[model samples]
Target: MNDSEDGRVQQLCSHDEEHLITSGTRYSIKGFRFEPPYVLKRAAGHLCRGHVPVVLQLFFLTLSAVLLLAVLIKGQAGMADGETPFLVTVSSIANTQGQEQAKKEKVYKEMSQLKPQINHLCRPCRWDWTLFQGNCYYFSKFQQNWHDSVTACREVGAQLVVIKSDEEQSFLQQMSKEKGYAWMGLSDLKHENMWHWLDGSHLLFSFMKYWNKGEPNNAGEEDCAEFRDDGWNDAPCAVEKYWICKKSAMSCTKN
Candidate 1:
């Protein structure tokens, strides 16, 4: 019970006053009951004869109780709101973006399950504008020299197609009605022997390579390329053949 004679409540006791914790959170003190919830209150009661201000004591104690209740109520409300679709964050502490995200994902999945609207789209490729499984598809029909084929693909607001996965490659190959040859988005003219798609994507991810015979020898005569039924082959780029095109995902939308 040692404090300044002037009477300023710095610490509360009494064993109990409302104490703020390390979390900047307020809690009701137990095991000790002092007139005020501050160490200074106990000091004044025991050490000082009277100079303590009763009004100040009541004000501080009541304020602490109110603040503690608010914190508890807010915490509980925040938890409840987190389970909802949208979260409104007052401060960083009550932020529940992760929970909200989960809720959105759950809702999205449930809605998707109901069934998709009937699709009316055109499929070209080596790209699948279709939504089958989790991948897309596209297939080319016109047989053009590798270069012309690429130009044709670009003309229709699409680019030469690149295979992102094995399933796509197999799908395109299957869709190739000619069973002869078709241009794909892959070449090494700019950098010999180092093949890459028109998008500058590397050939590291090719799953099923359909090179026709012992070719791509950079025969020098055939600079562009094509993916035949079950392999790859070198072909002239300027040749008048069918070509593949990849429309932008935004434009790929089925009308």
Candidate 2:
């Protein structure tokens, strides 16, 4: 064969060694020759020698790295999913407790407005106190004898409720429905069947008397009058019942 053929310079190993340089062989500048290995020569018909093993090793390493990364990501995601419910539950509980506290504070604030002050006109009435017709009215939560009720009203700079008009009467009637029977300012204790108001006004007109049917019969020495949903009833002065208190709206300091 020619010394140079098919882009390969055939060269003899120094001092007559047996190996022959064939096509696709490389040589160093110092005259050392390199030839493709048998495996690469068979696989690719004379490509570079030892590159196949390196390429396969790199591919496997890259594949292994990708798999490891995917496993780590999946594990982290699963851990997060497992813990999310507890975190969400705690957050919801905190929000609910905060809301309940806020509602209670709001209710207390509203109730505080009912507290009585020294002297102010048109000021808002305390909790459970209602305003009507330039007057603030309080419906007692507890029962007391008529005389005690009158005393209680006086302590608050008020008087037992005195109805001057039909509207006032209806208001008391409705209020007393929920609060039970309430003592009014009316009594016939001084004179039998002759009703008078706490302000010492005579019950002059028959139209102003909203007596329940067959009331004022004066049974059992009944003298004090109380009102219910129906109307007024003459009860004993010693009988205990809820009472209403009325104060002038001008009693509170005006803003």
Q: Top lDDT: which candidate number?
A: 2
Q: Would you list the C-alpha lDDT of every candidate in the order shown? A: 0.57, 0.71
Best by TM-score: 2
Task: For model 2, give the 10-residue run with minimal summed lDDT.
Answer: 9-18
Clashes of 1: 28
lDDT of 1: 0.57
Tell me the number of clashing residue pairs for each predicted model.
28, 7
Write the residue-wise lDDT of candidate 1 on 197-240 in tens digits. 88887777344345667877776556676766576677666665
Model 1 stretches with alpha carbons more than 4 Å out: 1-141, 177-180, 205-209, 248-255
Query: What is the Å distance of residue 80 in model 2 from its true position?
Result: 35
